[model samples]
Target: MARLPLTILGSVLFVAGCAGEEAPGPGGPGGPPPIVDANGVVPNYACPGSPGCEKAEGPLLVGVAARPITPVLETWDDLDGDGVRGDGEPFDDVNGNGEWDGVWLAGFAAGRAATEIHDDVWSRVLTFEQGDVSVAMVGLDLVGYFQQDVVKVRLEAAARGLDFDHVVVTSTHTHEGPDTMGMWGAEFGTTGYQEEYIQHIVTQTVDALAEAKASQKAARMKVARGEAPELVNDTRLPEVIDQSIHAAQFIDEAGAPFATLAVWGNHPEALGSDNTQLTSDYVHYLREGLEERYPGTTTVFLSGPLGGLMTTIRITGCPDAAGVETCPQGTFERAEYVGKGAADAAIAALEGSGATIEDSPSLAFRRRSFFIQPTNTGLALLVLTGVLHRDVYSRDKKLIPREQQALLSLTNVKEGDVLIGTELNGVHVGPLAIAMVPGEIYPELWMLKPDGSSYIERPEGGDFSDAMPETPIQAVLPAGVTPVIVNNANDALGYILPQTQFDDAPPYAYGEETEPQYGEENSVGYTMGPTLTKEFAAMYGR
Candidate 1:
């Protein structure tokens, strides 16, 4: 594999080769033993070296890229473009198959789009030496909770026996994309591309790693943090004063912007569910915006746990508020909100942090897997209530075909079905950890500290149908670690209610609509990001 000729920005180095092998290459960074060439033979410094040969050189990078994966969610027959399927339904197959197998012709907008199986991917950097760090990134239409699709991660991590915990996976929270978890109680619909799509991710990342290995070089680097006002908001229905600030991380070696890893907590709902074409949601927008500011800079966008923090506030409040304005003193519609506030926060961070291309990071990344069981409270109840609609349209409005059987019919969730707790407080990118969770994280499950939540210290006996963050994640980074929280890094996992509220709310949600409990429960279900965070920080924070 060939490197993309892109400059690599990273911290730390891990020597590669046999387990008990002696140092067969040049001393790293400032280590000596390179100027004096015995026999004028520069050691083969990259890739696989000659058997036991003490001198050889090879490439050091893996590879990376991002693609588009979109799914159709609506048909024309409903006239309103809701999820309903009608006689004049667009994208319907009126043929004698008894099933709408082929796309039926009708009004263009009303037709449900064809199903897709591809996801956009990014970097796959493989480290080839001791003290070396490699990274790759990808963004797909589906969410990544279904670790089943992570077979590629296992294979790649094991390609050289690297730890699976070393690989990081994430998803952008675009409501417009296909369901990552089974929606409407059915697991068959494309959650974008699930476990079956692992090969593509694996292949792309493997190539990326090879390339990164080749592109390795000694370069000066600096990390600067700034806030962008564009990413902020208080879009809650009641219009409370909250923030979802966007923070940009600028990394440059030799005084140039090589990459921008931006962290912000907000739903990637800007691309609206009505869209059927594959896209990276607000990520596409932000990536392009950053690219215009700095060319050749690989922009890896990470999300935060924004369920409770976001307001869906409309831009500039131009459209006024959503929901019942007169009914309450200050109520805002859920959809009228925008994320300009988050972007603004990042702008602020950028302006305040100044710029740094010095003092390389001390990087140490490790990954592992655990069995996660679904609380199933949310899905089970939705199914019983006839809310399970396998063939969902763009707006999430339920559709019914007068003569067709329901795709949402009850079914058993097999071993491979997505079943896991959500990360209660970690922002994620491949191998990167975001420990900061700002906003009112339900105190029910978090172990709050000035540094970060200690999720691993959590008590074991409890049940949640409930929901639940923080502060700047970087401030809490361990003495030797630099941590950043990418808001909404996981999913639109709803609120994390306290334990007292858990028993009261069988299904947790974070809203006034919640029953009389310590915390509220909603249909969206509770999150485990905090739990995952505690475990990860305890295990990986060195």
Candidate 2:
């Protein structure tokens, strides 16, 4: 743990143990009364470095709800407002089968529509309220969300008269879900987006959030952190992974647990690409296991800084039912093993870890956006050909040309100045400060590898090295404050890789025989890691 800043110590002591009362346990009664500020308005217990932390006077309130987002093939309608459905519009046979039902399952490039429904997918919402301000965190069982879609969710909720200071939407990055983003369609550059299905997600998310707010209850929070190395593996270069599993549980005043949020970094592809069922991957199993172990707890699994290829590739000693041993990777049994293993680790951490958030904890949120030049020509071609659905902005924030002809017509283009919108967010919940990444973030960008190696060598004149403790999480957060990265949060821009790795990776090729690089296949472009790290540091006022 880093050293806690002077201001952080003051803030923690300000709310520590709450006025002559013992700190409450996960299953204990409220510890102390709400502390009031000079204005008599309950002073928001803002952490030392948390920007835009909202203050409220009252007991903590939390609500948890979920809605089904499973797509009904029979009821699948026009999804993109393009007037007609499958009438010569670009539709790829993702699974390479002759028959095409126009459903592109995300996560795998071998485009396959959902052939069967293994289980119903869901959109889960966890809403928190303090005084007049409220924030909602939504988790969907999908591969990723575009920035436009992420913003649209907020806008749609607002249009429906739903009010919130912030509504953070993140896809669980489940490989088994429908292709919400257009990238995973049948063809290399085509889209399998169904507008109706997207609308269903938007509606379910808003509705669930509304119901959650309506079902608010006085709650106390307990946050604990533990490592589950057996559960996650890093497949990309430098072999770095964030094994830290952070669990935050909100216990209602009645002593019944309601909502639990867990953060980890492994890609949810435990079932691999061979299966054709619609599922939330290991996430569904993880949530089910956690809820079964602790009844009535709504569990939300968020991916962490796993951009440089973190996954469940370290398959060893996994066993299937009937006491038969299974392969180490890409099996349903492996998925269960990972999910149940994570649950066990979480239970162990929560049971004995002595980290307790206050009964009336402070809630604050901060967000900022930046632009990176699209350096990969292959990706640029996808953007130009109307294949990849991403909105590019100019230096002045004007919409850049995305159409093939328009982009081709422009001459003498400076690639670095052609901005792609990316964003980062800092959300403070009690003593936990969450750093949100819009894409899959490489763990090396935030922390140094266990072997003391780094993603990038220190620049000749730069003050900061490209390593952990120098990342957005450490730079923006005060020392001793709990920090976690919510990768693929709000928007899935793509893989945010370090500049050095980006340079080392083979050049991007749009043609049939592009050389395989470590992390560029799913990346937007290069140099995103440095840009995000700088912006995050600035956002937290480091």
lDDT (CA) per prediction? 0.34, 0.65
The TM-score measured for candidate 2 stands at 0.78
Model 2 RMSD in Å is 12.5
Scored by lDDT, model 1 comes in at: 0.34
- Scored by TM-score, the top model is 2
lDDT: worst 10-residue window of model 1: 10-19
- My TM-score estimates for the predictions, one after another, are 0.55, 0.78
TM-score of 1: 0.55
Per-candidate RMSD vs. true structure?
A: 14.4, 12.5
- The Cα error of candidate 1 at residue 295, in Å, is 1.5
lDDT of 1 by residue, 1-542 (tens): 00011111110000011111111223345332221122211122211121222222232222233332332223234466554454555554434445543221110112333333223323312232223333333333333222223323434544644422233445554444433333311222212223323455555555554454455443333444544333344443222222333343433345555555565555555433344444444555565566665677656566544433342334332232663232111112222223333333354555564544333333333232222322434443342233321211111211222122233222422222323222223323223444532122332233334455432211222243223332222433444433454332222333433332333332323443443222223322233334444444443442
Best by the lDDT measure = 2
